[model samples]
Target: MKQKQMKGVCLLIAGILFLLLFFSFSGIEKTKLLDTDGRNFEKAEVTNVISGNLSNSGSGKQTVELKLLSGDHKGKIIQATSSQSYLFGAKCKKGMKVIAIINESKGELLASVYSVNRGPMVWLMAAVFVAIVVAVGGRKGISSILSLVFTMLCIFFIFLPMIYKGISPILAAVLVVAFTTVVTMCMVDGITKKSVAAMLGTIIGVVFSGAFALIFGQVTSITGYNVSDIENLVYVGEMTDIKIGELLFAGILIASLGAVMDVGMSIASTLNELKEQNPQMMLKELFQSGMNVGRDMMGTMTNTLILAFTGGSINTLVFIFAYNYEYQQVINMYSVGIEIMQGLSSSLGVIMAVPVTSWIAAFLYSKNQK
Candidate 1:
């Protein structure tokens, strides 16, 4: 018990140190960027709102008093204007928070409302999610949360920074995915046969999914520019020399990793328990048992991956349907093609992970018994 406590303390300290290092590197990068425009972005809270009519437009204008929450002019009160249009306006109310942009181009400091602030709401939702996970999962939940944090750190610190430095995005993603798989499996299952099996299966599955996405994406001529923010991404790519085209497969790999990891771990852990309970069972029997469990999980897990992708772009589909797009046009559209590739590739990962995990677990457990 004391050893476990010591290990946990060491891990906590290491996590804190890693976070400090990550933020230090991020701050340096931010400072290195050239700020040609003398504009500052800050969060602020609305103290008051006054509504006024727009001349000959049937729209209204909202004049707000904001108290800055961050940046050099923190805690300073300023007035900003917002248009009350349903299409392109931020409808801010008193007590609501907003993002304010400070412009100092013409020797005068002027502030304007940028958008509604959703950080607090997002934080609140995250807190609720953590609370539920902890309540339901207990010790395992804590490990899960730690793994999640580590994965996010890897993405923000290792993956993004590497890509920003002109590294191949696909290679960086592969490295991050491999690191995440090992860490997450170890955290959840300890350094046991199950963890080893799950990690191996997840890596294989992710690689297969990534390769499939890249090959088919090329075959179908679905360029990464199909996405909504490709122009912005292209601008960043021009600055950093990053291969924006490979981002499609990189994104598919990362998105598929979690689902593959889940399937891998579930099958391996189940088979490990089965082996423990029935030591007399033959290796073939154990493998068959694992297959049975995998078969049961295959349907819902595949649906989960497909449905998740579908849900993300349901609005696009709705728009297409509303416009009465022809069947051929709908299927041939780049956006639709991308979504299909993502969904199918991820589902393939989940499908392949089951057998890979089961085979590894069966062999490992059989060897252990021998």
Candidate 2:
């Protein structure tokens, strides 16, 4: 079979297996009404719409009489209210769906109306994303989406749980990165020699980024809890054996993985393509091609990493500027300062990954092509 044919078959089988695993282990359970944990109150069914009218502010408020939909007190009618807050203006209307959390002892219900139901939207968006990906990239696109799904599952199911269970954050993070790299590469590039090169490159880049984060963290005497989120994690760690500093380092490394992967894959793929195009190319010429592509990618990839951080922290930057802190002090402050360090460190990882991966691929291609 042709290489493309084999890759296509492998991708299809992998996708089917992924879907099977997803549904088989979805952890769905039917719960009894009164016996369920965190069961605050039963879902209330609206029985009578007593008053549906606009108030002085032209906002619609509805007084709904509701009864318990399930459980022991299923037949009792009680008053429930749904109103659009004035800040939302007159857009609120009657019969708009809302949730009512009831108190059995007090026979009272608190209602909050949402503009949209997230449950349906989440599933809908996921389906749409998958459809669009498959439509655009075909087999490659499917692989990319599967890799992304697996990555998310590993983070949520494996990494987050391990961290919550008090495992060392850095250790958990390393495991997550390793797992994600394998899964992502396999799906994106298939189980080929090229994919293997990409995987190796990813490992090297990831380790480099992680080490830099650790070394910089120590040299700067920056506490793990310096950042607002990590500071909260410190309190969480106090309740468990999880070390905040290690976890913080793990986060820094993991955060750099995406960009590192980008650089690694770009170099590896470019080298492979060059080899295929000119089977007689020497190691020097191949390495030159890889470096040329890397040079182009390095600037944009690093900019991508930095801009992402900047966009996320723009609000914090604005707040600091508003406070009138001196420029030196503002930049030196730990709030946005750590992000700056992190961004630059990750950028260095991307810059370094290109050459290292390219060199490895250059040597490998020269040996293998002949």
Candidate 3:
């Protein structure tokens, strides 16, 4: 009866997730967008650029009034402005073709210049992922989904904000990684020997990644602060309070945390299940069995981690290509090369943690048996 009830609950959740994905992919609002092709409005011409003093703090902004020369809103003029204090610090000028988001109300047009086009496809893809998880994993799927959300929040709030406050990035990241390791393991596996073993292994792996990042960062002259956003950030705010180097260091550690946790828990659970299957095995034999499972997991987990980071940074490769940088020049480039090294180093940490943690967990758990 309990099994039947659990199956029912899983089916209900899967149904709801499927419905959400279906509705999102149906494009119920695609017709509402003003421009579908994401093309620039060449017929729109900015006729005026006026400077106005915004708070008399000696800082002002420039506004441009644009007139549409063609299309459905011909001869209609709209005003667009840029704040001087904005991070981008962009200034508007005349004769610039700009794409805008438009609002239509009761046959009247209200065009506002924001993003060029809508991104319904991205949301649809996320929905599909959610549906697949729910359909396959059931209640455990829900826990995994919540774990992902918690990870994102920790990175954005606890990790990034504290790093920006001039905290030691490596220290802050280690703390965050430790916290997340415990949280995710406890949530997924509950508070048990397996969870503890996974947590310990994850912590050790994170430390390794952080230490390697610091050493490489110093020796290679890679501060990880030379990215484009950091350049814009310097002009926009007082970065004297922020240790960008530390933030980068922390980012490297935190980046490894997710993969490390995955490997640790996978080994722990696999070993635990192996014990259940082979209750007659001695502790030493069980430890060996766990190490064998971990070895298999290490290969795939490292590949997954490295490939994920590689795919995420393909744009950096594209940028190097556009610049006509030679292979040696690209490899020697501080930021790109640093990330590549960090990704490889982190994967190595994950690989080492798996067997070590699995051996520890299997030894302890098997010895505890009657």
Candidate 4:
């Protein structure tokens, strides 16, 4: 117990140090994407609604009286027009907390409802999620949460910064994947052979996933430039050293990361348990057992990856059918090709990870037992 605590402290310190380094030198502080010089965001509450002209349809505009709860205009009353839109906008109601965009020009205040204040609700949901995980999983749940946080931090801080700093986005992503695999496995099961095997298998699986995505892109002539929002991304690329082209493969690896890690860790952990339960189990027997378990997981996990990608493209799929497009045109579309490549390549990663993890676990466990 003492050793475990000490190791945890060390890992925590290391993570903190890594974050400090990234924050200090990654140039994230210098990257300003928005022009917020004259505009300020403040919390406000809708005290009165005078929207006799408001339309029930998701369009038109409504006049809302807001009571500023924060910022320089605290406790001030302001009237703002809230535009109701299909994709964006807030339906202002009495006592509704909202974000107000305040723009000052010529000693005048021009305020509008920027968005609904969803911050508190988001935090509330997160707290509930944390409580449930802790209640159900106990120590393991705590470890899972820690690993989750660490993974997100690595992605946002390390992976994003590297790409922004002119590094090859795909290469930086792979490095981040490798780093996170080691850290996450260690968090879950310490430095045991099981975690080691999982980490190795996961790294290899992620690489294969990304490689397959690149291959698919090449064959289909679907490069990162073909992705939606290329205009904005290209604009950012011109400002920074960002690699806009390799983001597709980088995204594929990141997307497949969870499923591949799941396969790798599950097989490795199962094999470890089997070897522990029966020390006399031969290497071949252990390998076969791992393969049997992996086969069962393969179908569901592959389906999961495919379904996830399919779900993300649901809008695109709806548009294709809505327009009554032919199957030929649909299959040949770049959007469809990107979705297919992401799903298949990532699923392939999960499938291949099974056997690789199984074999690695079997070999290490058998050898360790001997």
lDDT agreement with native, every candidate: 0.83, 0.72, 0.68, 0.88
Superposed on all Cα atoms, model 1 deviates from the true structure by an RMSD in Å of 3.6
User: What clash pairs does model 2 have?
Assistant: none
lDDT of 3: 0.68
Q: List candidate 4 stretches off by more than 4 Å.
A: 1-6, 9-13, 20-24, 27-34, 368-370
Angstrom error at residue 270, model 1:
0.7
Q: Would you estimate the TM-scores of all the predictions? A: 0.88, 0.77, 0.66, 0.94
TM-score of predicted structure 2: 0.77
Candidate 2 per-residue C-alpha lDDT over 1-370 given as tens digits, one digit per residue, 9 for 90 to 100: 7776766786676557546645543553422223433334444555566777876765687676666555655666667666656543122333433345554435444443323223557899999999999999998898788788778887776676666556777777777787678668877876766777777887778788777877777777776778777756665677665577676677777888889988888788888888889889988888888889989998899999999888879988888778887888876678666787788878888888887888888888888654
Indicate the worst ten consecutive residues by lDDT in candidate 2. Answer: 89-98
lDDT of 4: 0.88
Q: Residue 284 of candidate 4: its Cα lDDT? A: 92
Residue 298 in model 1: lDDT: 85
> By TM-score, highest first, what's the ranking?
4, 1, 2, 3
Error of 4 at 304 (Å): 0.4
Candidate 3 per-residue C-alpha lDDT over 123-196 given as tens digits, one digit per residue, 9 for 90 to 100? 89998999999899998898788777766766665665555555666776776677667667755766677878
Candidate 3: where is the Cα deviation over 4 Å?
1-112, 116-124, 235-237, 316-328
Question: What lDDT score goes with residue 272 in model 3?
Answer: 77
TM-score of 3: 0.66
